[model samples]
Target: MQSLLRWGTERGAKHSCLQVMQDNAPALRLYEKLGYKEVYSYWYRIRPMST
Candidate 1:
């Protein structure tokens, strides 16, 4: 991940972003450790399922 970000920076990239599920604990922790922060929230609409 660091390498990828560095590569982008080398090419003049200004910012980076990614999406992860709210319930993803481990990934969230890792990203936080890497200096990421929550910028926004979103939801996915789904149809009701028949029982």
Candidate 2:
């Protein structure tokens, strides 16, 4: 992941973005260890239609 971010920066990327589920504590920890911070968060909602 770090290598990919570096490659993107080399190609002119100013920032890197990624998404992980709120329940994914391990992955979140990894990203945080790599200098990533949470900028925003969101959730999905769904409904069923009557037949």
Candidate 3:
């Protein structure tokens, strides 16, 4: 992840974002360590299928 961020910065990338589940503790820790923060929250909704 760090390598990819660095690569993007080298190419003049200004910002980045990612999606992760709120309950994913491990990933949350890793992203926090890498300087990521929770800017906003969201969710997805799907319609039920009829048989």
Candidate 4:
């Protein structure tokens, strides 16, 4: 992950963003440890397919 961020920065990226599931505790912890902060929260819903 850090390598990818560095790659983007080398290509002139000013910032980076990541999306993780709300229930993903491990990933959340990792990102937070890496200096990421919670900007906002959102919920997604899926519709069932009709037979």
Best by TM-score: 3
Show where candidate 2 strays beyond 4 Å.
49-51
Return the TM-score for candidate 4, rounded to 2 decimals. 0.82
Give the clash count for model 4: 0
lDDT of 1 at 34: 79
Query: Global lDDT for candidate 4?
Result: 0.91
Measured by lDDT, the strongest candidate is 3
> What lDDT is reached at residue 7 by model 1?
100
lDDT of 3 by residue, 1-51 (tens): 999999999999999998999999999999999989999999999999999
Please give, for residues 1-51, the per-residue lDDT of candidate 1 as tens digits. Answer: 889999999999989998999999999998898799999997899999999
Per-residue error (Å), model 1, residue 31: 0.8
**Clashing residue pair totals per candidate (backbone < 3 A):** 0, 0, 0, 0
Please identify model 3 stretches exceeding 4 Å from their true place: none
* Clash-forming residue pairs, model 3: none
Winner on lDDT between 1 and 2 is 1
Tens digits of lDDT, candidate 4, 1-51: 899989998999998888999999999999999899989987888899999
lDDT of each: 0.93, 0.92, 0.96, 0.91
Report RMSD for candidate 2: 1.4
> Model 3: how large is the Cα RMSD against the reference?
1.2
User: Which residue pairs clash within candidate 2?
Assistant: none
Q: Rank the candidates by lDDT, best first.
A: 3, 1, 2, 4
